[model samples]
Target: MARFKTKHTEWLLSNMAITVSSLLSSNPKPLTSRPVGRPPIEYVNAGPRQKRKLASDLAVHQGHNTSLLVHAAAVSAEKSNEEDTALVLKNIYLTPSDHNKVRKNLFTQKTDSVRLTEDEAFFEFVLKIAYRLKLKKWQVRDENGKKEMAKQKNTIQKKMWNAMALHVDKPKQNGNGNTNDGNTARRAFAKPKLLAEILGLDENLIAYFNSILIAISCHLPIDPTQFKKYCQKTVTLYMSLYPWFPMSATVHKVLMHGYQIIEASILPLGVLGENASEARNKYYKSDRRLHARKSTRQKNMEDVFHRAMDSSDPLVSSIYLAKRLGQQNKLPLPADVIELLESPNFLYPCNMDNNNNAPVFDANNSDSDSDSENPFTIEIDVEDDF
Candidate 1:
């Protein structure tokens, strides 16, 4: 009965944090082989300082190449009297010779070519450029660098776990018999603000992370236009920072289609989130164990069903609610969260109370006629069929 739709968003963010941390702690392996005709860019084994200088040089070269392409496109457009910018740009970017070669190799009359879609063809072209540039694979850490990476990874994980401890209760076991203190889903929900400071992440990356947290939050109302703009900026920043990090299907959907989905929903996206249903799972488990009959499987199911129905009954629920105490004061929402919200007033009359004292339901205040009767008691009849 565990719903995964909402949980997946949280998991994605948690996994992303882990992936980024791991990547930052170690070097990545080269993703593609060198293109046969292209000369290898030297300084593969260079230190950080040298790499930074080379990267700057590469940026300058790329800018120069882009300028040349733009100039060529403008000249070609004028000479051919082509008013269609799309066609002109395509023609300029993909030379006739390159197009012919791609058509022959990837889009032929053969069945193999028939299976290759435009997307795949484009990816192949990208792979070629990546190969020429000796770009690293995002996911693969260097095997030889594991010793140093392990040390760094431990340090990072320690910091992350410590930061997580402030918001979430430490789990007894992480399902592998180890007392791994942090729970990914809980951490995602908590959205610790110190992640950037703890990990020493770039400000741009920190902004991207914050945006992602806002996007996935079940409590916040999302504005489609604002979400779209934020999505685009975050995606661009992430790609610029780590071009080798292949966008997973989940991330692709969130970045490309999330705003559309939000716009299509009639209710606030937060209201439609799975938090309420997920919270009921604990109640379900407890009810099954403590209240449900064990005489027969059918009887056990019926008992559980009846108990659930009783709990959900509006009249019954209202009585319990009347006797229930007010909830503990909640912490104020972060500034970024408020900024992304469509209506900040939705969270008006913010709970600024620093008091730790919670209101308690007093038995003397009960409206029921029977003073001795306990409203919280559940009466279960045990069948002695055995």
Candidate 2:
């Protein structure tokens, strides 16, 4: 069973990597073996180490090693001494060549920020603006064609930037069909309350926007069904307000794929999330900016290995070092127990039967009369055409 879960996770990660590569590249290629050495690169901005680190970081942010399933499998496989299972779970044995191919597919040159979904990126934009963070800090130019640093002090500090942006998104145009150059442009920023009222941003709209933020933030319990319903409701509400409202591809994909990930698996959003990967990218960017000659291939390799094998968590570090030292040390807890600890859904009665042969499903025994019927079972009817 552990082997099956591990293999299933690997397959999902592989497929996700491939799908993302196909989307980003015009011509995606299958992963293949190649001679070991520094992989080919078009630029010499930094040495091979920086290139590898950058590539790996990009791949991770795009859901390559971001799968909780893979991590769980790795943990589970370390506990089980079964030779066949060990062989199947030996992913760390991947040659550098194959690993490079996986990274290439999972990331692309076009990627500026790691926010793959539209909604996530949108929220980030709003929050950054609200916090008065300078945009395009890497670049040294603004629209006014001046050398001035782009740091504008926002007098009005608002917590709900997304909600506010909606009110001011559509500006009134002059007779020439362009925004008024002088006073009109400044007035838009002056009276925000009036504009909010004009745009129908009442108490209800503000509440809805707040609710949407809470839903996507994943600060609440990791319930995919509830999350999916929230997403659908928010989208529907937005559409009703403005029928021609544009939605990002990422938003659409979230409704279709994001929630189902939780529904069909034991992993929680926090475990399978992009926060760690995103934070890692930020670290890389900061490190690179601090110096020019810092990104070496050996440095990249050492950093990754250290992060995996020498974690800050004592339990993780202990188990990883034990596995590395080839000692038959018992895991902190059994692999199955680890899964149960990480996921609350598994503790439910539906999955907690102790019987070895608890008939998979008693189809013949219709027990609608029983009060202990499967409360989880849900059904809905749909019409072919309305």
Top TM-score: which candidate number? 1
Off by over 4 Å in 2: 1-206, 219-221, 255-258, 278-304, 312-386
Which has the greatest lDDT? 1
Looking at model 1, the pairs that clash are none
**Per-residue lDDT of candidate 2, residues 18-113 (tens digit):** 356546897777779887997666535867888888767766776676445444555667786555654544553434356665577668444344
Candidate 1 residues 1-386, lDDT tens each?
25676667676566433356756667777679767884645676777888989867866877857646665667777677876864645664657556566567666545322332222322232222223222244433667445444455456556656776532223344332223222443343344346545544445555555445545554666788887888888778767865765765556776778789878987766677666788789988898899998899899889988998998876577654533523333454545555566776555434332452222334355453333344465678999998
Q: What TM-score would every model get versus the actual structure?
A: 0.46, 0.29
Local lDDT at 122 for model 2: 38
Q: Rate the local accuracy (lDDT) of all candidates.
A: 0.56, 0.44
- In model 2, what is the error at residue 52, expressed in angstroms? 44
